[model samples]
Target chain A: MTGFTTTESLAAYMPEQNIDTDAIYPARYLLLMEREGLGPYLFHDRRFHGDGTPKEGFILDLEPFSKAQVLVAGAGFGCGSSREQAVWALTGFGVRCVIAPSFGEIFAGNALKNGLLTIALPEEVVARIGAAAQRGARFRIDLEECILCVDNEIVATIDLPEGQRMALLNGWDETDVLLQEEGDAISGFETRHRMAQPWLFQGST
Target chain B: MGRTLYDKLWDSHVIRSYDDGSALLYVDRHLLHEVSTPQSFIAIEKKGRSVRRPDANLAVPDHVVSTTNRHLPIADPLARAQTQRLVENVARHKIPFIPLDDQRQGIVHVIGPEQGFTLPGITLACGDSHTSTHGAFGCLAFGIGASECGIVMATQAIRQQRTKTMRVNLVGLQSPFINAKDIALAFIARIGANGAAGHAVEYAGPVVAKMSMAERMTLCNMSIEAGARVGLIAPDDQTFDYLRGRPMAPKGEMFEHALTYWRTLPSDADAQFHRELTLDVSDVEPHVTWGTSPEDAAPIGARVPSPEDLTEATRRERRRRALAYMDLKPGDPLEAIAIDVVFIGSCTNSRIEDLRAAAAVVAGRHVAAHVKAIVVPGSGLVREQAEREGLAQTFLDAGFEWREPGCSMCVGMNGDRLEPGQRCASTSNRNFEGRQGVGGRTHLMSPAMAAAAAVTGRLTDVRKLMGGKP
Candidate 1:
């Protein structure tokens, strides 16, 4: 529900391709139910050992990276599971933006709803951002201007679909947006649909 | 030009199209499971909105339900609480629910089509990624997140972006002991994991045409593994026959009329596609994943790939990590890799046909001494049917546990998990790191291949066990 316009923060990079949702937030913690307080469980399997101790030299556990709000990750980031908790975990862990070459389609959609901006840049552009983040650069994500900056230098010009850009800028609840803008269209479609395809509604009522 | 099946389904369901290229798609069926619905229900309650079409939604507790001790309360407190919340939420919303103890209670994907809620030419959405399984019936089905689930619950529609269409033509001879799971993995390995990203892949050609509905579901179910949100097959006699006489399907004249429309649901011969691929399955042997991603798969005869062989830096790093996690040495033969567990269930390959295939492999043989194999049916009905057909007995006699229905070891949420460092030959969709359990190594394979692994104490070519060509 928080509007996202721009953020200048420490950036982190994880160069492993296909970092799936299960790794982001493992399935074992899924039963915790409530969406909040999932920060500790973010990358639970990767962050901790079997005895629940943090692994030494882990990138996120390191200084500066622990406070990172921007992540420049490898290709196919968040590429498994439809668990919205992955987004919840990322935002909870203070990651406001993720720049990757590609993302799991479902995870990308989920990220939009949660205000965690996902920017799918070209592979080379993502690599450049990852390199910058590895050098401890502070990145600025300007959603309104559609550009990403590192150390005050524009690294890549970002482009987002207009509707997504509007939603993120204003923090619009999609359900409310639909009802307010296209309520009549929904009702009319339902009425016309039932009459045209009566068999689809044969026994449900 | 002619239209694609996706275009037809999308056009029929669109309430309105936005200039940004996304459309408000009317959801005809919405499947819900315990794990994904809690937040959606909370969001809807906070918004002071009620379900607009409760009749269109079906709820079940699958992810957290214990496969063992079905009549008893859930053992894990957190899991129990989550399942209980679904019962309360669905009761309040008046959504039709299949209780955990119901014979029909199973993975949402399995039960939807089984109950006829997944009819062709409809737009179906679920909170789980495997919702693409319903697309096998020529439906516009794909997964949505919790917020979209909330929107669908309240408004019965979702704002969805248009997807490029792809036709994956399945060519080549149908190999023995090769199921749709193998074909899925084979093509995914060839195309990499994100092969069909942003595209709705439609499986076609003679090989696909000869597949059964269950096999078609297996292929579509793994569409997500290939980065495809939706996978489809043209509705044919096989699809209609599978749906006929089902509880919720149309009846009498209604069925006839539905068929008339469904007949026109396939992509026209001259339909345009954004991409096209031809998979020759004649060379697609039984595939087992050697690494974390589904794309890191190879045939049973192949050896583990060395990271040094990869030219790309990121791919090399991924393989190095996968090999370390799997405890597999580079150049190790895949068939010789030992497994400690054999899981023969999941929404991917837990249908009656899948059960029968595994049962046939383990009928007269016994499970290896070191392997702990289990057969968890997809649904309670599937379990009962397997029992009537004596497949359950065969598995039991083979030293395998015949358990109740639900996603057991696949997601590992129901107290069915592998210990750290355990290796499993599983018939599940994913081989992601720690997917079955923390530090667990999973080799994704077909049910028959898993059965072969169970009997041999290692990954074995399933054809050798079946007395066929190896």
Candidate 2:
């Protein structure tokens, strides 16, 4: 399990809210039938024209800002369906962390599982960070301290439950978690079911 | 401190908690559909296991077949195979099967509740995501993977985890013309998607009690949007009354006993929950998804939001991305935005009530010449009932194509699809790109709203089509 750490550089940001899976990866790209090509189409509809030419005034396509990773957004973030493709698209597009007032319940799961650190700050703090990003403020998020610290100053504290923090920091997928407890679960099921269903296991291997 | 519907169901299902964090929970009812059962059926075949408690399992074929021509061969080979496999598996398992031509045939979620099977204080699992629709009846319903479905088939149960209870309380009577779908959209958009993941959400408050059973189903159908496994509304007198006389419902003295138990299913007011979210239904209006996600919605009369208004990380990025995909100029009125197609079907809003809502709009009017419009009912029974009531003819007379039951254009996969760059107003569960077919943009809305889109070639307030609000 890799530590869920981020290299937050001091950079100002582009802002928007209510982002959805389709915008992250358009349907045309999903036709590729593989998760690998998905990243290229991340914001493809928003950043480029039908002919693949760059669209001017697009927030993601803007210089310096285009390279920026951390984003500050409004409350109720990741507010969409259970499509984990959105997270894959975001991480594939190079976003390492998201700072929002609140993250969408499913998107948070997808993000945390994929090593995308979600920083939930208070609404006022989120607004301040947005303003700072609008003015091109750059900073790095420290997963260990759980803060979005900017050039020798702390911008915001991000709170994740200790368990989730550990899961992210250690890259624990559902398979990994299941495997960790498989032995105990199987043994307990057998021992408990024997008494309840003695006839069913009379000749079990 | 009131107990939420989810808490009650979860407590009732506990067989034993395991040390490894999962629990052995008893399943009261198990629902199966075609899309996710084939692999499970194959697995069971390999294991030489017969479906345990076949009487407790119910099977319906939805999600893949076309509603365009029920009698005709399923044009898509993949869908045809899936439908065929469903028949074979269910027959072998000896469960009650509802095929396409059967009067009971419909979307699994619709049939689950309408057939008087989805009861309160029960746990149900189906392969389809929209199975959450059963939550309207106080059932703890959720989607499961194919492997889990196989387990449920062979053993009549699966290990389950207790869920945190999240209470969603609505306040005030909804504004005029605002329906349950509007309130649901508003709730998801308010909390953002994923607000209720890992939690069982209970729909409460006076506004919920005011809703009809079908309306409650519509509100609960979008539970996935909130990241909740299911959305539940406790059974009240209204619920019992709706179920008491149904064809499959318990009758006479047995019905009375069922009612006594059903009434007790609601939590006694002092029940506690892990979390609570509240909303005032009066503030909700005709809503539209401005962006690609269901949560990116705004009131129909509102303007497309600019990125400056967004203060969160992924949200800002999402808005920027949605604007790009939609090719919308900021500040554009959502209602005025033109659409190319209008699809009125899906497990979400394709019930008989939805057909009635849409028929009210198209009865006296023709669809827009440029908008390719169609009305697909959710079930064969709904289709027959609509025909008997002249609803189908009314839609056809309004220049809207009428179709049979199947998940048409909702998730593509079947013959139905939209041309690239064409935008549609759909009553389906999602508005994701290509979700209806590649490059097609879906704007999720209610049936009446879809009818309005069909009539106007743009998103319009359904009140305009109603001639006045109902």
Candidate 3:
């Protein structure tokens, strides 16, 4: 996962709420078993017509927005399905940060795991960003400062849980986080737990 | 201070609390399916990590297994590879696995509770989102992503943040025509798709207490569709009775001991919730999604909502997009919409009870000539039970194809899919675009509703088909 501290980029505005995983990357494309090259499939059903032609009116197909690195979406973005492909698709499309009023819980976790920053701001502030993005404005998201800025003015100060913030800032793999714990303590707890609840380990052998 | 059932369950599973407000929580049981775990197993192998407690985990190949015929080998190259990978990974790691040929093989969520792996007062994790189905047994069960699956497999614990609790009181007696799926769809429609975004929902009140364990599972299964990670109902006699004498359940004296523990697993009288809402199910008619999102649902007889009905411009625009994608028009009656297929199976509503309900509707009635109706049982056990009760014969007699168990047509990865522009009345939880297949439009409904649609060749209200007023 790429570590993130800050990025300043133009925002691609998607005003629709409940932009589900199925829309982000449709199920048909999920059989490949690999997450690579999913960016083209992002919003495939919505962005393309049945004849395989691009829908020019779709937000991602418009000028300037096609190369956007920030996605300013409406409330409840990524609200359906548990597929991590959704985050992968966004990152594949070069969307480094997603700014929404709120996000689905699982989608947010998956975003953090994949190094995509998900920033939750007040609905009013997000609406303002949506308005600004419509006018081709650019914004910067600083993870260390927990703030979003446009033209040197703070747009919103976001709230991030300490664990997620540090994980993003350091690009810490979960396995590394667990490995940092004291080995003796983990083994000691395991030994005691196995002894106390032998039935719990009945079928392992 | 009174604690809700979710609080009690979470508190009991806490292995260690961290200064950063996250905790290492013990997972009592972990369920795995093919699509989600292949990447996790690959990651574990790359890291050279062995599963910490293989006994605590169970693996099955459901998502990619072909549901058409269990006797034949999987024909799709990708599906076969996924199933083979899962089998090899489970064998190498020494985890208990249910092969596709095994009688116990089924959807991970269905097999967990049916095989007695899901018990009261435990913390369950699965890579799939519908793991909330286990919460029906009074457990703290929720979904996890691929990364979390690898973490739990390697360490038997997951670091988590405590979630706020929301209590949804379903007050009043429900109509007999209203099955649990209707109730869940109604709830999701009432609270928009993201209503429970970050909370664990506890279904309480009179209507919930009266529901059977299977119905409770149906209700909890759709928590994901509403953006909730966990949904639970406290265990009672219904739960204990459902678990007694199962293959994996504890024997006589131990069962009694377990019962005593389960008896103590309800929310306290004065438990506080961060948010509380009451839904009266007494008048909730059968619901069907008219658009891509689950929240875009209306009663069976209601007209499709136009974007003009929405006050917010964003919402209105979304409605217009959804309407265009679904190929629906404003004021179109839901019942008047025709369907090309009717799928009666998924983790959501494919249990024995669900089969019986659909069977009753289509017992002597033949499916309309133009509709392709298929009934895929949730698991082999469910299929066996349905066959023993002659439900399979009833469905077959009614021209509905009776198939083997797997997640057929639910996610459409295993070669069961609809042709482009085909509409389906599905019992699966999701109604997202292409959920059943590419360019396939889905209308989520109950099993009976789906069966009724099959017989009528359109979206007909089950109540109306039963000679009752719509």
Candidate 4:
């Protein structure tokens, strides 16, 4: 997990809402345990035709957009399914940040865990970014300042929760937080809770 | 201030809170499945950490296992490896496991409730999105990713921020043909896919309160499709009755004690919600999705919506893409849209009640010669119950393939899949492109609707076929 601070790249625009995990990476490819090499499989069904040839007009295949490391999308960007493979596929495809009006809760969490920054802006701002991306404009997302910029002009100031922002900035996994705990407090709480509610742990133990 | 059900649940589970509004919350039950657990187990082994609370975890292999022939080995190497990995990890950690051949072995969500593993006034987590299905018992259940699953496996706690509460009050008398699946679909269609995003929905009002436990499960099962992390129904007599004699339920005196606690799990009378919406289901027909998203749904008699009907340019573009992928036209009626296959099973609608509903529609009727229909129960217990009641024979006699329990055609991971250019009426939750198979088109609907589609060789209205006025 590499800490993310800033990235400037050509923005890829996918203007569809509810772009679900199935569309991100289809269920057929979910059998593999190894998460690597998923970039080519991202949107495989939509990006290619039945004969194993790339579709001619897909945005990812177009010039300039092919090198995009930032994605601008509509609302509900990663809805449906809790597959972490969707985040791995996006990161594997070199997308370091996703800008959307909103995102599916689980997908957003998965993205944060994988060090992929998910920025939620106002709908109008996202639409503007989408329009600008269509005109081949490069955009930058600065996590430290919580600002999105195009051509050195600040376009939108995004607000991310402090905890998530720090997690991405420090590349801190949840395990790292857990390891910081001394376990004495947790054990003390558990003992008191068990004594108070003995019935709760009856079947569990 | 009166707290909502979600607030009460969250407040009870908080072990410690941080300034960032996130809390370390205790998890009462953890459900594990094959596809999501392998990576988490590997990560734990790499960290040299053992499962902290094996007693709180229950493991099963359902996603990749073959739904046909229980005695045979899984043919797909990847699926076989995943199932084997789960078995090995569970044995190594001494977690409670239900093997494939066990009568109790079933879909994770199905087995949890049936075995008394999922109860009210507790918090549950699983690696699959449909974990919300267990919320039918008034539990705060939601899905988690692989890493989060690993955390829960190690600490029996999850870090989380509380979500706002949304109350969806279904206010009308539902028709007999309009089952819980129809209610869920109609609600999604009205609210759109992202309508409930960032909120926990508590279903109330006359329609929801009247539904059976199975029906309530059906309603909560598709909450993920609506972008809701959790969906709940207050515990009532139906929920308690359903869990009374289950194998894992509490014994005599303990049962009475548990019931006293369960009765107190409902939201207070004057509880306030962050958002409230009421839907009148008096005239909702048996609903089905005509396009890729669950929100792109309509009554069985309606035609597909045109891109022109959409006000937003992005939505119009999405509709155009969906139309091109589905090979469907704007004016084409949802009914009489010929389907190549009919799949009547998934976590959404594979319980015993769902099977009985489908069997009733196909009791003496034969399937269309051109259609391929299959019925996969949700669990081994469901399969046994169906067999005992002769529902399996009814399906087999109607030319529907009666198979064992697993997530078969709902997801195309297993051998069950549709070929290119094939269209299907599926009882599964998702209808995204290639969800059933690569290049496969799926129309989400209820079991009864799928059964009627199988018999008519097209998407037909179940009511019309049942001798009701169209």
Chain B TM-score, candidates in order? 0.99, 0.96, 0.99, 0.99
Candidate 3 regions with alpha-carbon error over 4 angstroms: A49-53, A182-199
**DockQ of each candidate relative to the true complex:** 0.79, 0.13, 0.60, 0.66
Q: Residue by residue across B1-470, what tens digits does model 4's lDDT show?
A: 77788888898788888888888888888999988877788778888988888988899888877888778889989888888989999999999999999988888988899898888878999999999999999999999988888888888788888888999999889887788899899999988899999999999988988898888998999998899999999999888888888766676787788898788778898999999999898988899898999998899989988999889998899999899989999999988699999999888999999999999999899999999999989999999999999999999999999988888898888889999889999999999988898889999999999999999999999999999876
Full-model lDDT for every candidate:
0.92, 0.72, 0.87, 0.88
RMSD of 4: 1.4
Per-structure clash totals for the candidates: 0, 25, 0, 0
Compare the candidates by DockQ and give the number of the best one. Answer: 1
Residue range B309-351, candidate 3, lDDT tens digits? 8899999998998898789999999999999999999999999
> Rank order by lDDT, top first?
1, 4, 3, 2
Docking class of 2: incorrect
My TM-score estimates for the predictions, one after another, are 0.99, 0.75, 0.97, 0.98
Cα miss at B60, model 1 (Å)? 0.9
Candidate 3 lDDT over residue span A1-205, tens digit each? 7888999988889878888888888876767677667898888988888788887778878888888889999888887677888888899989999999889887888898888999888888888889999898978889999888976689788688788888899998787577567334455656675554443555655
lDDT of 1 by residue, B1-470 (tens): 99999999999999988898988899998999999989999999998999988888889999989988877899899999999999999999999999988999999999999999999999999999999999999999999888889999999888889999999999988887899999999989988898888999999999999998889999999999999999999999999999999988998889988999999999998999999999898988999999989999999999999999999898888899899999999989998899999999999999999999999999899999999999999998999999999999999999999898899899999989989999999999999988998888999999999999999999999998888988
Better of 2 and 4 by DockQ: 4
Worst 10 residues of 2 chain B by lDDT: B19-28
Residue A42 error, candidate 3, Å: 2.3
Per-residue lDDT for A204 in model 2?
A: 33
Best by the lDDT measure: 1
